[model samples]
Target: MTPPKLRRLATAGLIAALLAGPMQAAAAQEPLVDHTPGQADIEGGATAQQDTNSLDASLSDAEKTADSVLTVDQMAANQRALASEIGPDGSSLGQGIERLATTGDPQVAPVDADAPTGTAAVSYWRPSGVYGVDVSSHQETVDWRAARNQGSQFAYVKATEATGYINPFFSPQYGGSEAAGMLRGAYHFAIPNVSTGAQQANYFINNGGGWVNDGKTLPPLLDVEYNPYPSLGNSCYNMSAAQMVSWIRDFSNTVVTRTGRLPMIYTTTDWWNTCTGYSTAFADHPLHIANYNNSGAGTLPAGWTGYELWQYTSIGPVVGDWNQWPSTLSALQAFARNNTAPAPSAGSAAITTLAGRTTKLGGATSGVVCGLIGGGCYQNYQRGSIHWTATTGAHATLGAIRTTWAGTGYEKGRLGYPTGPETCGLLGSGCYQNFQRGTIHWTTATGAHATLGAIRTAWAAHGYEKGRLGYPTGAETCGLVGGGCYQNFQRGTIHWTSTTGAHATLGGIRNTWAGTGYENGRLGYPTGPEICGITDGGCYQDYQRGAIHWTTATGAHATLGAIRRAWAGTGYETGSLGFPAGPETCTLVGGGCYQSFQRGAIHWTTATGAHATTGAIRRAWAGTGYENGRLGYPTGPQTCGLVDGGCYQNYQRGAIHWTTATGAHATLGAIRSTWAGTGYERGRLGYPTGPETCANNRCTQTFQGGTLTWTPTTGTRITYK
Candidate 1:
């Protein structure tokens, strides 16, 4: 008996011839004889006289008279006849002979003609044209060359199962079959219960399920059948027929998407009908049926028009399962080429045509149809894609501009579908693509930019590239404080907060806004468009928290929060406190805030809201240490007409008084009461000469009419001259 490895070598030689080309027809004149035990004799050969009880004498008279030098058609018929006798189980005269021949165990007793074969049998119906076999580790190693020489025309080798589990014999069997000139394909045994169909398909393709359009390679095959669970009594596992069908479809679709070739289906008729409910969705894919009964090709699973390859018997001239393709070699080759070719779908025809016309796109690298988004299709290439839409037709997007568009959400994003092809030779040798919603611009200096919605409208109104704003430099960004969006331009920025709508800020106003921390500063976000016709023809833009006022007089100043409100209350620049003279300064004396205006200045502290002081009143308050001095932040605006026709403003600590008699002076505590009692400036003791002269633990201020003094020990005293 031949060793398993040696047998495999011999088989490899036989199968190699089938893959290389058509087999040479055997000469009709040669006489043939069966040399092994349990053998048959061919016509024109002398009969061997052996004991009837021995294996060699078991052949029927009809088998003994079979023709030895047979045509391809004749060989296919004989294989089918023998497979019918074996059936699905290893029973009958045919299976007995095959087991004795393959395993070389002559002592094993033969089963009755109608008994089960223990092993699953291939279909019995013989296909009249080409023939082949599928193999796995179960066959150990195959004599592929011998199998091909004996009339096998093609082979499908088991490659992977589930996510893991690779067939050890796959490499040798695949190479041996291919080398023997057989049309070869790889198959995956799907375990849908263990993992998803897509995952298994990916694993299968990555391992050995992939196929090219080379004439010798066949499309991949999927082997989905009875579940391998031992404890379960049913073959369908826990899934219903519909679920099984869905699993099979998912696997087939995934395989087609990755390899661009729909896989052939390998399943028995009963399993297909019962487990998959006779699903017809996969009718377009080729079928490889396994039905081991003698009924021939009378019935098939629903959906399939006819079978391509039929696995007819577990035992063949070689030591592996046998199959047959019911067509001539030329027809088989054409089928392979057609199935592996790029087949167009609904919207893909236009994209396919576009790709053919464009030289740079090369060929499509992916088979995913773009129908999921828009009513279009896209075929991706090395550089870009050939995008097709019913309305926009077909166009090509490539290079940096394409990259930029993809960054902005591709077709599903704000840009939507490409309306026009990429155009070059713009202002700076740039390129751009127009989309349904907006346009993407690209240049060496600016890279690629997207401008859309209101921001784009504003940019266009400003003359776009020719205007002061120049070209856009970035995509529009949202999620601003006031539901606003913004995009940067070459010369400046366009802001679109809710209150301000869409507006552009440039030059000094832009600079001043930046210095004040832009939107993040005390001014917050812009609330309204900038106004140009304020007091002195100044421009001011309102913000969420306050406003920034700009003019030739004040440059640009931001007045916000309490101080801004105080200024607004005074009629802004039109009333007393005119345009801001300077930006608001805070963290001042006594933790106060202040801003200077054309008329006067407004100061505020936590204790004192905000009050304005001007002219001599402001000077008087400043002299008294302002908020930090004896007279703190003003408690009220200045008022005229005291007892002596003087003006005074109250503060947190004291008050400042001004009159013609004594300019401005701060009168506080007991001195203020004493002065007021003496009729202040109206009576004889008029305004004080100076602040206060202190010595010998006494404080005194000499009035115009008399001298007033105070001490802790003496309380108060007045000296009149």
Candidate 2:
């Protein structure tokens, strides 16, 4: 398919001038009086900002990459400027195809390393695989359903070309393929000498190359080959091997940020060797080698060990260039679904991120440059700077830490550079630097801080950003309680005392410590670090007073006083009970205090002291209405190992006995006196079967062997079972 623009009058004078002239930096003649969403600094570097040339200037998102662009007059002026330059009507995909057709240039590197060319006859003989077609504006109204009938499993539609022109038929061709139940994708034609690779890439994506993980949209393809406009520039577009590699890298990395998948490279081996100087940098990128031949995709370019697809011929089965996917159809569909959509590209990434601050940053000290450690790009300004990576997107770094980083040689510094923005939601409203050596945390209260070594290690142990401490608020401060130093975090604090070294005090344990007046209180400073991995996922931290226990179901709570002693005797968290569920509650019956655990609670009082009541006995006490009921707060811990595997705990008023056979039942008041006379669990009555029940003013307690009946009118009476 040929471009209609080819019919326009040819300028012989302009043709010679453009072909011989060195490429000058192109600028846009657009006003940059304001800011829009994704608009970055001008592509023509500092000169474009000065508006020196009447060329194009990228002022806003609309002017730069978005669909809405240039005023009618400005658009017409740009079209007029390039009126004679739209020479070749062919797509980049067909440059080598036509060249091989006429000149018999070798489609593949000759089997003999010294051979210069090969026959064109075998180049057009189609090879077998799952086939597909590629379309451009030339195939304007494609009957994609007809193409599907022709067994084209996938389709690649030309979305944009050279940063200026978008295929007018891109929508119907791209959409119609999917509508006809075929996989489809978008591709861009390279005019490397015309604009930056990022510019052309952004233009392509904004037009129709944007992808969704719909299992039908293939990875965006980059159609880079011999320059179709030989009258305008040479085959390699005047780019040296290094520049060409950098240009492709810039374009690819930009696409990765926009869509998670690395783009499929569509190029023939001959052009690749000529342009990239046989560079092996892009081995990871999937290759769609264009070697139109009856033989295998021969002598694949430098990097790729295998090809994903082979463009067998430019001659169309219908309306476009047809290619083959050697794998099964399901494999191709799986390929589409595998690369889920990633974060959308912010046009030029770092440049776009730094757009709003262009005025503040002044003019560019250098052009946008990439090929960093992680395929990131950066642009320097008179003040500050902006850096971008696929993982971190784009963020500007300034202030003291940035100055320090810059002084240490930017990315070559000890900490590498800030990977993200100086976000301020951290502890004490601080900021971060996710770097290599150590993070630099800052807060208004403590200026700036960069910590490594032991302090940072302690912070890391507490879970870094997601931990209880969260992001550090300020630098470590040495001084107070037990000659200790402490660093504050978002939610808690890490204290390093001479005695206990460094330990985190946060969450409920910290709250409990606060209640006791912290270090000044009974607990004093931590005696040892918090040790976790006790039974039932519990942790304990020792203090001068006692220790705090923590768990997922129960929060961190301190075990102190007499209740703490009783818990310790029972093996703390590993005892009959588990971690502390809630804080200690006081002012119960007789001014008693109690703290709940995973199993039960430890009740403390002046008379009953403290006793760990758990399991069946505790439930029996609860049934008897706790400390206020017939069976008051437990006076002794539950004791087991008796007849019938029975366990019992003595209360203020009576006792509750339990066995596997008889659940648990409290025998108190008159029943207690009667049961005691018969000897508890050893007499004829045995362990209590169930709780006492009252009806018609008569209360009866059933035992394992007999029944004990009592009432106000009638005294206690025992009946044998």
Q: What stretches of model 1 exceed 4 Å from their correct place?
A: 1-189, 192-374, 377-398, 420-433, 461-463, 478-485, 494-521, 574-577, 581-583, 597-600, 640-646, 659-662, 678-721
Question: For model 1, how does the per-residue alpha-carbon lDDT over 615-671 read when each residue is reduced to its tens digit?
Answer: 887887777667777667898877787766778888886777777776776777777
Q: For all candidates, what are the clash counts?
A: 26, 8
TM-score of each predicted structure versus truth: 0.51, 0.37
The runs of at least 3 residues in candidate 2 whose Cα sits more than 4 Å from the true structure, single-residue gaps closed, are: 1-446, 450-471, 475-483, 506-517, 530-538, 693-699, 711-715
The per-residue C-alpha lDDT of model 2 at residue 212 equals 68
- Each prediction's Cα lDDT score? 0.66, 0.68
Best by lDDT: 2
